[model samples]
Target: MLATTRNTLIQLAEIQHQLQTIHEFFNKWQTNPWGFKEEYLSEKVLVRFLKYETESFANREWEAHRKEIDLHIILQGSERIYLEDATKLTEGIYHEKEDYYLLEGPSNHFITLSSAIDQENSLFLWPTEAHKTGVNVTDEAVMVKKMVFKIKY
Candidate 1:
């Protein structure tokens, strides 16, 4: 789960270089939808495609991916993402393969993420960060545009 400002993402040339690979993959399924898949680009990074239906709320326990940074980009719809500091993560078991740990306790604080009004870019998430993404309680289908790229620290 990656979340951050657009400017921050553009500054990372390594990430910018990989955008083409992501775009190529996104172009294949823009008309359709699917779930997460690992697209290996090289030893330094891997692109992950994720699709989730928009709903009132989505609470998830993520497997920890230590030392890797996540780049999240929205490709279709709009939704809010909540992120909390991993140090405050007091719950959830570690699933090494998935690369994120679930949080059982109440989150202390969170950063909110929504669609970019100006451009399409990726949001970066540090390793061990705990986060949640979805729409608020409402009766509508929210199309979420996103891409998660794993980067080695």
Candidate 2:
């Protein structure tokens, strides 16, 4: 798993893509609802824009992907995201088409959503990591707008 900012994403030579294309396209998606649903940024990269309210983790299951890297970029609001090693969690039945499985266990590590203020607004989770997201930062609920990039590796 990796944690970095959007601008840093472009500077990393490791990720294969036209950085300008993604940055430009991202700006467009942030402003218009027409670009809301999941869309392909490249042959192996897909982006999904979503908005929802933060909630308690009481009964929610952590999730891990088998075939993609999840990069979550928070556009607005704040929340806490819990992440843990996949091996520490109990096994879960896999859903072939969706490519993910829900895990059961406690998350011992987490990162509160960062923004422009911290220069690290994005979190990356690979197949080796399990995470429970959309968690409230406080007792009060907060609305969040985020973009998730699903990249097959």
lDDT of 2 at 85: 90
Query: lDDT per prediction?
Result: 0.62, 0.79
The stretch of ten residues in a row with the least summed lDDT in candidate 2 is 11-20
Write one digit per residue (lDDT tens) for candidate 1, span 1-153.
Answer: 456577766646656555566666657656676566766876766877667766654444433457677777777676655566767757566666656666644544444345657643445666767666654424775666567777775
Error of 2 at 77 (Å): 0.7
Give the C-alpha miss distance for residue 112 in model 1, angstroms: 4.8
lDDT value for model 1: 0.62
RMSD of each: 5.6, 4.5
Candidate 1 least-lDDT 10 residues: 56-65
lDDT of 2 by residue, 1-153 (tens): 556787756645555563444677778866874745678888767888888888998745789998887889988898789999989999699897878998898865888985558656888776758999989878989888888888776
Clashes of each: 15, 0
- Which candidate tops lDDT? 2
